[model samples]
Target chain A: MYTRILVSALFAGACAGLIAGILQLYFVQPVLLHAELYETGALSHFGAVPISAHPELPGFDLMRDGLSLIFTMLIYTGYGLILLALMSLAEDRGAVISGRSGILWGIAGFVAFHLAPGFSLPPEVPGVAAADVTVRQIWWFATVGCAAAAMWLIAFGANWMVWGLAAILLLAPHVIGAPEPEVFAGPVPTEIAALFAARAFGVGLAAWVLLGCFAGYFWQREGVYADATQSA
Target chain B: MTTMTNTRSGLRILPALFALALGGAVIALTGHVQAAALHDAAHDVRHATGFPCH
Candidate 1:
């Protein structure tokens, strides 16, 4: 059972990663490269102070992009494993993951991973000012954890009290609030940042939606059928 | 194929092992080396999560 879950996750994740990587290369990378030029003084935004040029790393663009693709693939594949494991567990309890309702699973994956966190922190473009990384990382993890739990409860929680609690947890992160930059000063233009943010969000949404559908489809293929008797 | 795990445990374990190793290597590489693009991607996720992982 675990082996089936693993293979399914690897294949599905790789597919999502390949699709997302291509999408990012086209829709997202150009925007990032554009912003980097500003960051590196190869270009400037609104005549911002002439920033010092940092030494370029070896392998340059090619290495970075390759690594980006590899990293993206790895991350999604790992996520796939987790999602499949969850589905199997859910199946054990009689939830059927099939072609028909898989897209709903995909949407849930999107909401839990991308939308929930996105609501708190929209994607940032290159050279944009932001708060300390550690604090933000902690908060972001907390939010993903809370939001994921809340979403699960919303989906499968049996009681109204569970739903009420889910609502509170969902709101908890926002109420506590994400940490903000002390001063929002960066060289990137607002228009460019806005475009980048929107595109990035779109990219994630598309990828995660794909993740969900793939996970659900592959899971069913692995033989997790609904047992009518158990479901009752 | 499904029964392989029951009879030939090794084959069943191969895929999981391979994935684990590949996943581990990638994580190790990303952890030690800070490539800007990777950093940017992580930053986007972190920032999207409203977290600053740098």
Candidate 2:
């Protein structure tokens, strides 16, 4: 059983992470590279040459982009491990797990991991002013934890009080508020920042959906094989 | 039957715990680590995937 769970998570995570990394490379990385230019003062928003609507971005560097791809896979695989663990727990509780249901799981994952925290602390560009990293990280982790708990309650809770608690869990973090920098200032244009945030969310949604589907599929397959081996 | 189910569930718990711990550690390393080299290596991804970063 342990090996089955581990193998399922590893395969699912690797597959989903590869696709997510590629999606990031294509849709998200260019915006980041562009933001870096403004951050370094190479392309200033208010400079002599106003930034063009579609300025030429730096071409990909193999080293930088390659590292990003590998890291993305690692991060998503970590997410996969956590997700599969939860799914396994759910299955033991008599929940049916499958690729179809996994889409909903994926959406829930996105909401918990990305949307909930981002509601207050939107993704930022390279040069953007922000709160201290440690403070922000604490808030981010808290929000994700609360949101994940809330999602589980919403899905499996049997009564109104449980639902009520879920609502509180969802709202508590935002009400307390995310850490913020006293002054909002940065070299990157707000337009660029906005674009970056939107694309980040978009890629996140796609990757998570894929991750859920893959996780669910592999998990089911592993269960079948485990049973077959037992019978054999 | 009840004892069999209990034993099976008990077997399941250890792996689930292990997965959660390992997964959480990997995410912390990639997304939350504070070292400069780690930050630079994960910079673009940190931004792209929406992990909070400098």
Candidate 3:
């Protein structure tokens, strides 16, 4: 039973991690490259590089980057934990796939993220073009928030307190707005937003811990004796 | 008479109360209106399948 749980979680985590990595490579990376090209004409030559135009690995850079890795791990961890949690429910009832419960949880989480804002780390150098900021900043937060919340509520519960608290803890700084310090004496518009994304992803890491515990409970199975069948 | 009394007693309010609580919870949790992203995604997904949610 324990081995099954571990195997299921590892499989789920690896798959989720790979998918997340691919998304970063194919979608997010190109967008970043485009933003850089729009900002500094000098960087346009670098942007012409096919590698920059297309990200071949999604979550690899995310894993390597100190901040991005945190989010990638959160996604991977969440998937594994969720799988475990559903497995536990089946163990309690019987050793079978509770397809209904599993799909319900998955859909719920997916929907929550869809409704919430997207999130991502901001670039170090501020860009001159408004398009770059607007596209990356607003869209990313909205999309990520929606996606994260959907996943969270399903994996956790519909308890508004849990949902709202998770959202606030993860996204408050960005969603509520952050105060930018002027020690650098520079206007960095995406700094606060990026902070919020980073913080929210951190909260997601904590949530994944809950996922692991719940998964363990759900996947725990009781031994069945052959003689027990006589009672039925 | 005893069986009728027992049957009446067995039909308790707990299940009804539990159902009410669950329903209330579902409403409370989902009541907070969200942005259009989910709806948009659903729309897109549905359109691709030629079965629009609209």
Off by over 4 Å in 1: A48-61, A224-232, B1-53
- Candidate that would win on TM-score: 2
Interface RMSD of each: 5.7, 0.8, 15.3
**What would the per-residue lDDT of candidate 3 be over residues B1-54, giving only the tens digit for each residue?**
989756653443333333334423332222211335533322211111111122
- Comparing candidate 1 with candidate 3, which one achieves the higher DockQ? 1
**A51-112 in candidate 2: lDDT tens per residue?**
67677887878999999898998999899899999999999999999988888889999999
lDDT of 1 by residue, A1-232 (tens): 6657777888788999778877776777766666667667666644656533442423326655665676667667866765676666566556888755666766776776667766877677767887876676567667767877887788889999999999998889889888789997788767667877788778777887788788888777765433433476
Which candidate, 1 or 2, would have the higher DockQ against the true structure?
Answer: 2
- Candidate order, DockQ descending: 2, 1, 3
lDDT of 3 by residue, A121-176 (tens): 22223242223333333454355444555455545565877776665645653565
- Order of quality (lDDT): 2, 1, 3
Error of 1 at A81 (Å): 1.4
How well does candidate 3 reproduce the true complex, by DockQ? Answer: 0.03
Candidate 2: which stretches are off by over 4 Å? none
